[model samples]
Target: MDGRPMTFAKMLEETYTDGIAVLHRGKLIYERYFGALKPHKPHIGMSVTKSFTGVLAGILVTEGKIDPQAPVTDYVPELKASAFGDARVHEVMDMTTGLEYTEVYTDRNSHVWGLRRANGMAPIPPNYDGPTTIFDFLVAQKKQGEHGKAFAYKTVNTDVLAWICRRASGLTLSDLLSERIWTQIGAEEDAHYHVDRIGTESGGGGLSTTLRDLARFGETMRNHGRFNGRQIVPSSVVEDISRGGDPEKFKPAGYTTLPGASYRNQWWVTHNPHGAYMARGVHGQGIYVDPKAEMVIARYASHPVAGNAANDPVTLPAYMALAKALIAGG
Candidate 1:
């Protein structure tokens, strides 16, 4: 550690992180555990799981098992009457679906919470008659704006994509991920997903894995979908995610924390010279990959704030600094 001490222990103490892992040039540079997190423990990935789902969809497309331009209704015909019925698989993958649901986490009655209830993460009321499953919740969504016109962050869109992955691959999300990604990449341990009553993986935000394994995934992406001597995911898939979607569409989303950032295939693109990208989750879960610098950072935290907006001020700068240090040292 020749650079200024950004040790994992110090990061945990300073950022209230549950776990932190850093990989530079595909080697573990630092790792630490805090607040009951263990090497084998699997903490919820939250929206970070969205990236996994997106990548899986990409793999399916590469294998000729799916077509991104196809209508989502082709896979989940039951959604034909819903807002997502006309949505393209690529639109959902890019989060350009124009759904009426709001993602305001501060509000108890927000549509995101309703999704949590439907996905079985939150307890439902006794007399609740809304959608009982994630699929149902998505099918019941109302159209708010035209699809493919703007970037709108909606969890239900990912859930619908997950369902498509399941239907297309003829396997559950967990099985598909394990077979296509986790095991192939030599994951340190088996990751698990929280399931609903009928055993549907939450898809939108329910997978969990240890910091080390998460770092491995980040490194895999940094390597353009190759890992552990295998092309676990097609290079084209990674290129699409790294290239990112239109910044103009992203501007309307109003992510003040990420100026000049774009979203594509469930990954957040910084569009900086280093070609940095990230998989982020609510409440401070992040996997930051800087391909030019050959650095990957996996962090899990239970920050007081629910959205990344609050943490980005400190985290974004810190990551850029760390990447610069790594590049200089190299």
Candidate 2:
């Protein structure tokens, strides 16, 4: 140890992490809970939900129910007038839709607020009435630029993919997830999502799951889709995400903390030596997978800041350091 006071403990304090579970070589090496969170309760997964959406998309694709190159209108005709109408399914999965939507959370009138209002996360004003359902808000989106030319971080892309998943599978995102992954993963508790007025799951950012279950998913991903003596997620899907998406496309997004990383199927691919990647949510939720070190970290936090920009510096370094320690000391 480099005289750096046990890094992970420091990170827990600095990031206001609610719970953390670390798995090394398929074993629980470290586990703890803080604040109001417990082992049994499901904490909000935030944008981590997008990663879940991505996994479901992979399942649908493997089942031959989804066509990545197909236009969004192939499934959701309501989006035919929206920007996504011209976009491919994979484009939405990769967030290259080129929509005019803004995700600036601090702004009162940002598109994110409108999304929150539709999904039951924000308070609806008595006198205001716009799109109250997720479907309505999505169809209202229009094009801003050329699709497939540049990567943009937009939550609505995941929502569109969720709708497409429903159309392709004839199953709601919740039910499809329950059938395809959750039950097979040996999750300790049932997970859920926040829904809209029409009971549509907010696939963009509304999942909730226990820290242990999150770790189970992470470990499954680390093992390339195998868990609990079965193939929970397809190995091909894991390989695609592990191989990563195009960095050239991801470069223009300019995430300061994620330099040289690509967004693929809603997962952030870190082109680091460890070949690390993460499913990240705003407010510090994550499933950091380091294939080289055979390690997976599942964390749920309520940091005062929403973006990982605040948490990544402290959390990422700590994770790498711990991975090194586990690998070398073993």
Candidate 3:
């Protein structure tokens, strides 16, 4: 990536990339699958689902059914005693709720693990007694600090958004997606989210989709929510994400790999010269949209490392180099 051709095999090995698809000038330029991943198989999108949930919220926002400035409890009163009780809808969208939850993966006691259990992602023992639904897990969270004071990456915010979406629109996450985005965009396959005991879709990290489908969604976002001759997502929503949340709110998150980046509507705005932004998740899953170069790169990976820091150094440079090459060739 440093002024050299990237070694595809070497980078894939280093990052454990399962599937990748790249689009240039609004057309497919590259694609591949590896290591038990297939074109038809739907791999877990992880937190990439958050971006989808965020976009769906945008659809409701456009309909005048949901207001970003409204308090979450206005939609879901169940959160009245939790961290999200007094948080604004926009605060949840921006992940600044200041929840007491910790996401330490190695710590079995972390709130993330509890989230997994509640969202049907983890196995439950016979004697296990805890929150049995994503809603239950979310309502148990306690406030830790001042809301809207800082940006903290937490999965529960998306779950809360999903709940609000359901309450505001009277549609489940899966149903709303199919009715609004998936069907309109002409996705190749029917993607799904893992649901809890109560059949509540895990809006935070439960969606699974094929690599090509991921690219389609990324292209939809790149085109400002227009795809397949339809307005699948509102252009205003995409514009808001591209404009990004407050950099002052994002700086304290300590994402050294993402200097000058901001989180908005669950997308990461790089704020680089090319105006690149991305939908990122744990273990290297990402949908990078490079608007300046007119390119989109969708990837589904199973890297052994869960943190983006493990692969961002290699991936980000390669992505920019590809974007530059695509633009220069034209």
Candidate 4:
């Protein structure tokens, strides 16, 4: 050991994080829980759930169960009249759909809040009369720009893709994740998803899992979707995600915090030499995998800021620094 104390407990205490876990060479090197969080507790993953949805879609694609080139409406015909009618499945997976929904987390009236209401994450007014379900919200969305033209980080796109995954596989989001991933990855505990009154998993931002299980998932991806000597997800799926989407298209998204980042299959690609990529969520949930350094970091937090931009400056550099140190010691 370097004796520099990269323990998760220290990281959590110093950063004010809820939980932190680090895995190196498939072994737990550090782990910690703080502030109402425990090793066995299932902390909210926020949009980290989207990465699971994306991987499920990849499995469907690899199994020839879903066609990425096909119109999204092909699988969910109910959306034929909505903005997604003309969008391709890949567009949704890559978050390139130009939907009018705004993801401004700070705005109470933002489409993200509307999504929270529809998915039953937030309390709605008694007389509120908007789309009552996620599906309804999708069906009611209007076009903002042309699809496939640029990247727009919209949670609805993931929810739509999740619906497509469910329809194609005939499995709920939780079941698909459980069967295709959690169980196969040797997850330490069962994960749960927050659902609406009708019992629909909030595929966009509803999952909660132990910090160890979250690390297991990240390690699985780092190892090309294989864990416990089994192929949980097709290697190609991980390849596609790590390879990332078009950076040119991502530039217009204007993520000032991530100057050279690209969006791919709901994962954020840093495009650095270490090939570090991440599954990030609102309020600071993250699973970072650095292939070159053989490191994986899973974190769950409840920062007042919903945007990762506010947290990335400190967290991103720290992650890179730690990865480099791990590699140096090895």
Candidate 5:
């Protein structure tokens, strides 16, 4: 893929993809499993969970339970003294907040590790006096720069949005997801979100689901949030997300793998001719949807690296090539 032609199977192997399901016109066209994954086994979704949280927030917004233009403190007053004190809900949802927290995964001292420990994804030392809960961790964050200025891929913003969604809807993340999405998608198996010490779902990146279920969710988004003969998510929300955010805001992030791409409602918009976008996670997990080609690809993987930069170069080209082939043959 770097220069020469690469086969689809070679791309999968090179990216360490565990499972993938491709859908065309709401029908299963290709599916495969590898590594230790099975058709029904739930795989860690990583930051892909942020997209789910975003959709849930959109649902709440459509119901008039949330006001995105309002300050973050309007829903969670406790964060009024934190970095989010001067931020708006929409800034957090779009990850354009100027928080001091750092999310470099390879840096052990990065603030993301603190979040992982607080969210029950990492080991906490017995003498650790840092924030032990996600809420506490969020409240301790400090401001770095002006909010709503540029895009920064921080998991904490998604958690903050999830917290706002809970406050506005009077429902926990897991319960809300089950009631609004999981149950409505006709999922074959139950999905779960890893929780913090006080049973709060790690809405940032804690979701796990079967490959097929992931594909279903992708198809739902592809169809403008309708699936299983019902409107699972409002068409307006999907349309807004599909329309995308400011690429200028997304450019400073320096994601060389995704030029001219924007982050909207936790999804990555390609701004390409195919009107393609994706919900992506660390270590290669993703749901790539090409609207013009009527294609959706849901994948779970375990790459040695934790960033999508490694996976994008290999997988993204293959996806686009396949989309072009589908359109040409049709």
Candidate 6:
């Protein structure tokens, strides 16, 4: 893809894709599975869960339960002494909150592992006595720099936002998601989130859903939040996320593959000609929506690498190529 030719099959193989589905104008065009994955099985969504949390927050905002301009402490006074104490709700939603936590997946010692351990995603060491629950882990975070100044891809930000959502709506993350999105989309199967010690859902990276349901959600976004004869997500929330955040803030993040891209409400906005945006997860899971071409791609993968850098080189170009082809003929 970078000054070289690659086939679609080669891209899928190289990225270690497990399953993928493509929809155009709300109709399934292609579907396939590989490796140990089956059509009805639910694969872990990784960070894609953050997008769901973000959308849920947006819904609460529209309901007048959450004020984007309000300080994080207003909702969760428990975080008043943490890094999010001084952060605004919008900053957390956009991931612009400056926190000391780092997310270098290659580094086993990175703060992300601690988060995993706290959120029940990773096993805790016998001697390790860190926070065993998501709330404890979040309350211990320290501020790194000025909030709302630059973008940082830290998972804790989403967790904090999830706490805010819960405080405002008086509902757990799982129930809020089910009531607001899953059932509204007429999901083919039940979706779930892994929970921490105290039964709090890991809103950052703990969701699991089938590939077809993922495509349904993707198509819902492409159609301005309407799916299955109903408006699942408010159009205004979709519009705000699709509009994107300031690229200047996102520039410092240095995502080489996503030039001129911005993270808004946990979704990555490409700002390309197609006005494409995506909900991405570690290890190649993603829901790519290209509004211009009316195409939605839902993919679940188990790439050997944990970051999108390993898959974007091949996948991004391939997606654009398919969009171009569809625009030309289909």
Best by lDDT: 5
Query: Which runs of model 6 end up more than 4 angstroms from their true locations?
Result: none
Give the C-alpha miss distance for residue 264 in model 4, angstroms: 0.6
Question: For residues 93-199, could you state the per-residue lDDT of candidate 2 as single tens digits?
Answer: 99988889999977988899998998889978999878898999999998998999989999999999999999999999999999999999989999998999989
**Cα lDDT over the full model 2:** 0.92
For candidate 3, the 10 contiguous residues with the lowest summed lDDT are 1-10
The C-alpha TM-scores of every prediction are: 0.96, 0.98, 0.97, 0.96, 0.99, 0.98
Clashing pairs in 2: 283-306
Per-residue lDDT tens digits of candidate 4, residues 140-197?
9998889999999999999999999999999999889888888787777889999986
Give the worst 10-residue stretch by lDDT in candidate 4. Answer: 1-10
Query: What digit string (tens of lDDT, one per residue) describes model 1 on residues 71-115?
Result: 999999999999987889999999898888999999989999899
Count the clashes in each prediction: 0, 1, 0, 0, 0, 0
As a TM-score, model 4 comes out at 0.96
TM-score of 6: 0.98
Kindly give the stretch of ten consecutive residues in candidate 1 with the minimal lDDT sum: 1-10
lDDT of 6 at 10: 82
**lDDT (Cα, 0-100) at 297 in candidate 2:** 97
Alpha carbon lDDT at 230, candidate 2: 94
lDDT of 4: 0.89
Screening candidate 5 with a backbone cut-off below 3 angstroms (N, C-alpha, C), the clashing residue pairs are none
Off by over 4 Å in 3: 1-6, 125-127
lDDT of each: 0.89, 0.92, 0.91, 0.89, 0.95, 0.93
lDDT of 3 by residue, 34-126 (tens): 889999999999989999999999889999999999999999998999988899999999998888998876688988998999988898868
